[model samples]
Target: MDGRHSRISVLMFPWLAHGHISPFLELAKKLTKRNFHIYFCSTPVNLRPIKEKLPEKYSLSIQLVELHLPSLPELPPHYHTTNGLPPHLMPTLKKAFDMASPNFSTIVKNLRPDLLIYDFLQQWAPSIALSRNIPAVEFLPTNAAMTSFVIHLTKNPGVEFPFPEIYLRDNYAISKFQNVLESSANGIKDTERAVECCEQSSEIVLIKTFREIEAKYLDYLSELTGKKIVPVGPLVQDPVHEYDEKPGIMEWLNNKERSSTVFVSFGSEYFLSKEEMEEIAYGLEQSMVPFIWVVRFPGGAKVSLEMALPKGFLDRVGDGGMVVEGWAPQTKILEHSSIGGFSSHCGWSSVLESMKLGVPIIAMPMHLDQPINARLVEEVGMGLEVERDMNGKLKREEVAKVIREVVVEKAGESVRQKAKELKEKLISKGEEEIDEVVQEVVQLCRKKNRH
Candidate 1:
């Protein structure tokens, strides 16, 4: 066996969202190859889907631990994740999760892991690790550019409103910016939590980005956080075979022409509002491009998608569209020869996934880090965000226009070309980021052991 990673045991605890959990799981798989023992911890329901992905071979090296979510009046034990929970009740889940610290602390003391890699939700994790003399790493699984932007904002609170010159220069205006930024004190806590975790941690800020794409941002993040920042490459997954639900998604794509269809999804955590969903439906219907759209609902939502969408929208877009309810094999769909563009929510993973497949993005960013992700996509020339009105709502015509521009029209040639070039660059770099991180981690582990 290679004496590379030196049998370091790491406890990985990501935020409750599937977006957060998936990347940790992917990292766990990669680290196990480096012979790092991983104790992958998450709530039971969140870990349920990924249980089988770990083969019989790595069972001993990569172990799954259930950290149950405490029951609250707003979020019960049955409600395991933010995936299906409504927007209003999210704070309840966070509250319950925060309350679980004693239990997590108990597990940490008992296990005495070598390192703790955690996500943004838990501000308390870094302290727990330090209290036990275990090194802690804060993991940022999104684009480095966005994280850098967040850090820049956190460090410079005096800059004040109107969203820097970059966002202001374009047709994208101030009112069209993030609601949390304009209206309330919301989202500040998460930003503070991330900075706190970074400041408290002993190791580098581990991000899911490559140097070539976001090197400047990486340096800036390091400077801002007062910690070394290590990029873990893009960490993009391809054609995930874990779930075998419907061959129909592939079948429909097979029938479409090459580079002619748009794949649409908003990741698992976000469920669009009725008006927003209807507008998107109208937009997709009007796009006139062949499309596969994945739609999700809040777990307790009583309405079916049929009743929610615009009346006659399905009948109008028939033959040219395949509207899917619930989960879709997104990677497989993106990998299809006919899949040309992605109408995405600008979730960092989805953006990277589309770019990884050389599929240009029709960026429709929703809340949180998405707006920043959208801006970065625009900056990089791989995608275009749909323009919104003064009231910050999308129009069907604009939606169709952006999709056509990204996919079929001559206007999007640069985006298409850039996407292909980016895919080549990101994919070819492969595990260079991983190799570097492994060396640093191994060194950190060995040094700690010597001490």
Candidate 2:
């Protein structure tokens, strides 16, 4: 059992959510090609689907490690992930996750990997790693623009963010961001957790962003935190690995004219309220644009699409629009030639997907860093935001107008072209970001060994 292998062993742990785990998995895949062996760890519930996404070649380089959270009455084993958990149980889930620190400690001690790459919320992970003489780096799956904005607000309460383009204007969004910052679990607020995680990072904080789009934000984030902000590129999932096999959805996309249709999805975690859903439904109908909308409800919720959406929605938009219940192969849909625009909630992962695939965005941010991400979307010229009222309520007219312009109007030509150019630029860069990431990570591990 002597350490003779050249491959670096890394234990990768991300938050128990599809968005966070996905980037970690993609980064793991990238590192595997550079002589890095990843022990991918997450709850059994979250790991099940990820197992299927891994190709046969990655089987040896990447090993799935089960992280068992204690079973709580409110949060059962199945609810270990944020995928289908009820909205009200979010706090319970976070508390349960905090309670699992001791369990994670055991995994770290037993595995004794040379390095640990952990998510933002779990500051204790780095603490445990340091105790075992293992260097831990924080890998934030969110973009730098939003990350810097949050940090600026926290550090300079009254100071205005230097970058005015990325800001929350609506009162509703501003209040929502404040509420999230103050929201606490286990007697600690989310902001405090983020600060601690950043402070504990070995020397560099690895983030999911590239310099081309966020060079200033990255530099400012480094200034604020005094940690080298190393971007790991987009870490986009390969469309080939997305083997869910949605033949029906793909066939529908195939029938649409090139760049004639829009794809509407609000990410896996967010479930729109009935009022919001009705407004969006009316907006989509009014836009007269062909769309593939994927609607999701909370886990175990009995509300069907017919019940959630406006009555007769299915009948009225028949053939012109497709309303899919639960899940859709989003990556596959975006890669299709027919998907001209994406009406998205601007979740970081979804934003990156649309950007990488050259699909312009009609940003309708819901909450929690999304509004900021939406602002970045517009700032980058790859998308336009659907303006909301002063109170932050979404209007059907505005939604319809934005959807039409971004997908069909001549005014949107620049944005569409910008998206296409971004896709090409990303393709040209290839794995450049990951190479820097590998160098920083390997150097950190070597430094730890020397100490």
Candidate 3:
């Protein structure tokens, strides 16, 4: 090891889900590329997949440190992958963090890294960083709009009720059939705690969204925090499958008319139930459009797809559709010339990627801040949401109708055009300046440490 090379270690307790881990991993990779000796600390189970996914060259530069934690009761025994960390598991996760703080503190003290970057859910990291006088930064794995929404919700508690209520009333029929419970103030107390923790600590918050997209909200958040809101993102990589050969889907897509294919993926974590899967399959079949569908194997009784989908659904779609089971190159798929529309679970990353690639969206929000993302997409006039059934299930007919409207109907052309314009704004032929943002973040941490 040479003294010439600077070392920076990042400790992230991602919310035990793929959506959280993937963005953090991308950040870590970017930092590693900038000649930082990177140490990625995560749960032992979570670390394995990341290690497996890493290229041989990356493995040489990046070090993985696995922390042992007792199995979470909410997490099933077979659950090894990161997906959606259910809200009900928050208390258990908090307790785990409290328990791991001392161990993490010990590791930081021993390693003595230049800076510590953490995820939003890990409230204990800021306290640990403060104790050691090490500069820390929070990496939010969501868009600026959602981050701004969260910041506003923290400051004015009253607004949270109306936002979700308004979304439910205007977009989804679920709110009408079911008794929509207003979240107690206690529900967002953790967010307040996180903000307060940041306020007290000598750390800056680095959000993973662009200021160009959400300037006004970012400006307001910056003023409120009295800290810089650095939005350096839509952090994504070219869709290259390192482990496997490229699927012929891209070739098939290239043969089609420009912006004619609708790319459908539910992110890495969202698994559909069998009935839901069949409904979606039927809907796609009914729509009669060129589509790419990423399907995941069923997990449990909660949302099993094994029994739900009809026999030979894949065969039926045949040449018209491509069904990718695992690890589809999403970024590349979105960038494809044939991709005109995105039917998504409204994960922030997927939404940003679709928008960045200039694809209009049909948002089917499953849970979490998905509804919020859906609203933002719709407000921007580049997307539409499917109506939910009385029991909160998305029927095949509804999916078919929305797909037809977005992909087949004449009315969707305007939305498609608007999405393309937005894409042009984001994607440039010139060099991307993400490294500059990384350097700024590094410099800010150094300045904070000197103080």
Candidate 4:
């Protein structure tokens, strides 16, 4: 190839999960349209489902390289991904991912990529770029608000429990933050470097959120990390429920009155406990609104759908409810006029989807950045969080109250209106930020000091 046509190539290796991988692919699509070449890497099992979903334009656009996750005795191939893995086994997966560094190093050496864009878990990636005389960036699919908060705390380790309400009201979240702090301070050997990879990068953190929503946080992040933080326009693609074509789902939704039914999903990962599921079931029954709720159990979870919920609960809401055992095409359902509200776990990606689609959120944040994301939704008037007890337990009555308020009551008209307004502003709007980010990335790559 001659110099005139040589395109700048970026090697992107996101963490082994759908939520982490999807946003990187969306950003890859935007980058490809700008004539940038991309080498997207992930485990084979994780890539299988999404490979077929790529559009024709993207068919040959990204070089999807499969990096086999080393199979450990404790966990098999399927367990490598966050979708099915139990919450407790996350540390095991992180260790397994770090063990694959030699494999990733081989690919980077062979490709000689101009830029290395890696997930927060793979801190060693930047070393490859350092060896090759180029720059690397840490691509965080997490929203800016949470990212900023974490970085700020990382910078100021002794800030007297910075966020009082979030930390005090939600002990689960506080505990998670404590883990992050302790881990960053002293995580295990393989992960300590990976977790701190953002600081190791050449002064640029590319996140899946824009400044319009969290400007203060973004500015604070820059000051905290001393890196030029770049906002990537909340890369939220319309959810394509791989199972949306399931004739029963759309048909059942069609039968319901407009804006009367909701699509309830707790994300692909984060399986609910039996107590949680039972409370949600009772709440749905009490809300008196029709819903299509998707439920998922952890890899080794022994409970059946019948065993998981309250006895006769299914029979009680027979016609009014549709319970899906696994994945559902959430985006397609949300697009349908029948999906008036989204009962979500408030994962950043899910939060962005609800915003982009104008579907109001009934936030029930389980852990991690979710609690922070939930607060942002309420701060921006996009959704209403279901109030939790001091123990951080989600109650049936509160669930019923919020669900009815968001989907079926006159009192929540403003919240509903604000959600739709956000959709129009985010989705129906121009691609100015989307287009501008590519230019910013190009400039970042062009900077001469990295090598």
Q: Largest lDDT belongs to which candidate?
A: 2
TM-score of each: 0.92, 0.96, 0.83, 0.91
What's the CA error at residue 196 for candidate 3, in Å? Answer: 3.9
Candidate 3 vs. true structure, TM-score = 0.83
Q: Could you tell me how far off, in angstroms, the CA of residue 267 lies in candidate 4 after the best superposition?
A: 0.6
TM-score leader: 2
The ten-residue window of minimal lDDT in model 4 covers: 183-192
* Whole-model lDDT per candidate: 0.80, 0.91, 0.69, 0.79
- Please give the range of 10 consecutive residues that has the lowest summed lDDT in model 2: 1-10
Of 3 and 4, the candidate ranking higher by TM-score: 4
lDDT by residue for model 4 (246-266), tens: 779888998999899878999
Residue range 44-100, candidate 3, lDDT tens digits: 768877887787778866788766555666654334334444545545555565566
lDDT score, candidate 4 = 0.79
lDDT score of residue 185 within candidate 1: 22
- Candidate 4's TM-score: 0.91
| Candidate 2: pairs in clash | none
